[model samples]
Target chain A: MSQAVPSAQRTSLAVPTQVALAGVFAALIAVCSMLPPIPVGGFGVPITLQTFAVMLTGLILGARLGFLSVLLYLVVGLAGLPVFSGFNAGIGVLAGPSAGYLLAFPLAAGLAGALSTVVLRRGQAAAARGAGRMGFGWWALVWLCAMVASFVFIHPMGIAGMMLALDLDLATALGADMVFWPGDVVKNVLATAVAATVIRAFPALALRRF
Target chain B: MNLLDHRPGTSPVHRAPLGVKYAVLLVLTVVLVAWRQPVVVGAVLAGVFGLYLLARLPGEFLAPWRRGWPLLAFAGVARFASGVFGPVPLSPLDALGPALVVMAAVFGALAAARLLVITTPGTELLDGLAHFFGAFRRFGVNPEAAALAVNVMLRTIPWVGAAVRAHAEALASRGLRRGPVRLMGPVLVATVGHARATGEALAARGLPAAPEPKHPGPDYTRGA
Candidate 1:
């Protein structure tokens, strides 16, 4: 059953390929960040598609590239490309109220990628035990991992940033951040579905050390 | 597809070395953000305007601000309301002044950053950054790879934007009302596919594995 796995899945990518993938995903993240926000329920921070893009990058690109891609996006935005939410850019945006959330992007991507890799390895092991193609189960695990990563990394860092910038107590900051939960669930689900589809289409999509 | 804010020009701002311009921009932004006084903020705004003129930016360069008008209005209105109706009330006049000053500082900072973007081409800016980070190469960091990544990112941004628009339209035409959300899967698949193809192309070009060092100055370890 292990022999049934595609050769591409086991093969490692060249360094250039890894770098290019990271760059491309970084560009995608920037584009997503720059998209006009969809105002949700009058919260000052509008719902942007950036988180979804970050998660997708993580799941598809794997840990190292996922982290690099997001970090690159932040660097580009800070370098003044108007790539931040609402087309605002520069170091000030990073230093401003949303700084925590901004800073957490790379960490969120890293955690998501790491968790996905762990789940994927487990799925492969199961496949080696004569289990059928690790199809829906793999995707479900990916979704769960992405959600957990978001909960652990993105939200906490974001709330902390909000507290500092807004001068709100932890409870107040959490309350303000709570409005994003429902929307984030939808975004994470969408990202997982997209990533799963991409991986299924290209068995060698995820990054592996060369 | 026109993702870059830089416009082709021969103004002093364009001619100035990237480092000097960026250094000035950084210092100015720091000062603007640090000084909350109306006078300081106003002076910074005026100085930014002067630089804008010197940079020879077209009226269209300011077009990005139109998007912020509603936010600016909301900020003003919200500030006024809070001052008048809060537990410790204040005169509308007092509240309005602070709100306007805050708004002005924000606008000034944004304009200053935009000016930097508008005058600097992406490649030059990245090269400048790569040079700045080249100092870290001694610590086993590959600044060249980082620079290449940034270059690829800058070049690919417009392509990604176009892909999103094309994907969204394709979905809409297929009767998917929520095109953007529905767009996620297809776009990701397409983007990954494109990246793979790009990677293959770059490999095919036989680009050297190690980029040549920009400044191969004195090799002390090599008996220099």
Candidate 2:
């Protein structure tokens, strides 16, 4: 324990810190999905704050760590923790139509994160030193990142999965997929706003690369 | 099944090493992917279910099906509609027949994993994973880091619950009220604080909590 290791004082996060950050975000994703306050419950409908947490994870953590975080959550849930949306878990969910979207989470988080670093203009060299304010334009771009990841990757994959698992045609799956659009947009906004606020409060949290 | 739902047992399955159970799960997944024959997959499903009962667990062996019925019903209806209305007009039974077999294979894999979790203690599972990951030390991976993260996650779940309650009460006293937006902001802030604290703790314990700078800072490379 006495070895300072000299790595702790670096501008970038240490390896254990990075891993811990990812784990924290993964837990956050699980808590949001399984939140009792807004339980999706047994309705089997997919809308929940989980997506918000997932988006926030990307916006705050950036690509590599973001993907790692969500992937960790997925692995844990698959290991049988009832950590998925609506408090459901296990590999059985893979058989469900939403399995595609569930599987697409890490990719979506990574893509959103890849876009956020550019959109936020956070530097690669050093962590932001103090509280920093982001403009509405920045928030919009981050929102766009989350939204694009959701619509472009996660939703389409979900539709394709439903098509395969449920044997539905493209048109039918598209209709079902549309139901999530409005809730998702609102969620993306909340996630973006929260991410902006967190960064504002702690500029170092604005997602700089190691 | 939930981790909290684990029931202790002395059955061979329960007594088996996690490595053995994990290997079985891996083999099932690899075989399922490599083969398409429903009969082969279905046979494996039967064996897993039989093992579940043989272990005397406290639930229906068909619990996966029961939990997934809404999805099952929805798929059945959708396939039926497509069969009758599509231009090609195939029989509903014919369409659903293939999907069911495939989905069952998928769930069977899940159930097998669940059985492993249900029979094993959480710590044992974590230890098994830590051991498994330890072999990759040459690859720059810290196996214990992952297991530690999971430990923090499970431990922090209770903290999340407490934070929500405290935040709600504080918000109510000030007449600020609580909605997803207001509620989420502070909760996230708290969780972030939690992360920072955990990072600091890990660092103090001499774990690599922060990454090394690509270009060393002045103090970083100073020699004795």
Candidate 3:
């Protein structure tokens, strides 16, 4: 009882706040998919809002709970709810070309969230004067961490899905992976840029409501 | 099988037991996986589309596709590009048939799923899942937390989606929408803080603790 509320001034939030934020992040993933994507090239993979959703879920929800959120989305999709990109769902999707990416959502979210937390802690401590004043280089490092995780974990799973479903060899699959890269990179850059801006304007956006 | 809380009006599919429905969906998915031939896959697609009609699912039910179709197209293109650019040497024409068929099948199945979910309430699905996995207690799993996990996931997906958009719109108002890096940076920060707080809350509530195991033998407790 002597905990004295642990000084809410720090990073963590109360229980109700966490639930509220989790709900908010999940909803953000869904809405991000709804906005029309601007296609980058002939490969047809336009940079959509999915990365922002997955990364934010991980960065905010952490490894376990963040995984839970993406898993829930997948379950909802499997159960026939249209929570996926384009609002499509069902078991058939699990076997299709995109199955790998679909399956990777939770894993990707978990990886990104875990990696980002490390950066967040370090960044917070380093930026001792005024919570909002983050060194630009540190912000760049956080971006690199997120991008690397997505590229390493999510993309490979996605390629495997393509290979298995499409009966393509690794080379062929890599080709497909390349197509998604440019567009995804663009999305990541955009997501990160917007994320930084939000922090600048509403530092509260940087704080967890959960 | 409905995951979202929205159960539609009375229908045979909606009324079916969640376990049975999930089993059927799983079996069908396995069958789809087992059969790779385009003819078989096409047949499955046709059958799924037929089911959509049978369920009386509305055209607007495919509403999410308005935004999603492009992503599917991109993926399809990526598949073909990989085939052509890489050592595989698959003709674009060859890739198109399977890609479109796969996309159609996926969309159809999702459409069917959407109809069912929008109709069924979430609580029913949770209770059904809890009862179905009731035996997992032996593994030190709390059926309640497991069930709650499912519920929270279902509840939050749409929530996170809305938050991302609101953040983006707010950003856009200030004339800031060029790359995901810029957009997601703050969102990530906000998200991490939220996750930590959430974990703390669950801990405070005495969660992460396993529930009592179910009785193992035939000569069980009082209920037996």
Q: Candidates' TM-scores?
A: 0.80, 0.80, 0.68
Best by lDDT: 1
Lowest summed lDDT across 10 adjacent residues in model 3 chain B is found at B1-10
lDDT of 2 by residue, A173-197 (tens): 7877886777788789899888877
Candidate 2 clashes between residue pairs 3 or more apart in a chain or in different chains: A13-B210, A13-B211, A14-B210, A14-B211, A16-B208, A17-B209
- Runs of candidate 2 with Cα error greater than 4 angstroms are A1-10, A36-46, A86-88, A122-132, A164-169, B26-42, B65-68, B78-87, B91-109, B135-139, B173-177, B208-224
**How accurately is candidate 2 docked according to DockQ?**
0.36
The recovered share of true contacts, given per candidate in order, is: 0.43, 0.40, 0.40
Let me know the DockQ for model 1: 0.40
Q: Provide DockQ values for all models, in the order shown.
A: 0.40, 0.36, 0.27
Please tell me which model should have the higher lDDT, number 1 or number 2: 1
| Tens-digit lDDT track of model 3 for A1-210 | 112112265465444444445544565676566567766666665676777667656654566556766665665556555566655665657766678988888888877666765675566556754444577787787677669878878899998987876556788777667767776766565645655554554454334322
lDDT of 2 at A179: 68
Better of 2 and 3 by DockQ: 2
- Writing each residue's lDDT as its tens digit, candidate 1 over B1-224 gives 25565687999988899878778878876776567688998998888888888877757445546855554454345445545555566798877776676567556766777788778887777777778668878886578677777777777888888988898788778887754446777787788787777778777875315756688877788763
Identify the leading candidate in terms of DockQ.
1
Clashes of each: 0, 6, 67
- Which model is ahead, 1 or 3, in terms of DockQ? 1
**Candidate 1 Cα errors over 4 Å, as ranges:** A1-12, A38-46, A95-97, A127-130, A135-140, A160-176, A206-210, B7-12, B32-39, B56-64, B70-101, B165-182, B211-224
**Model 3 TM-score on chain A:** 0.81
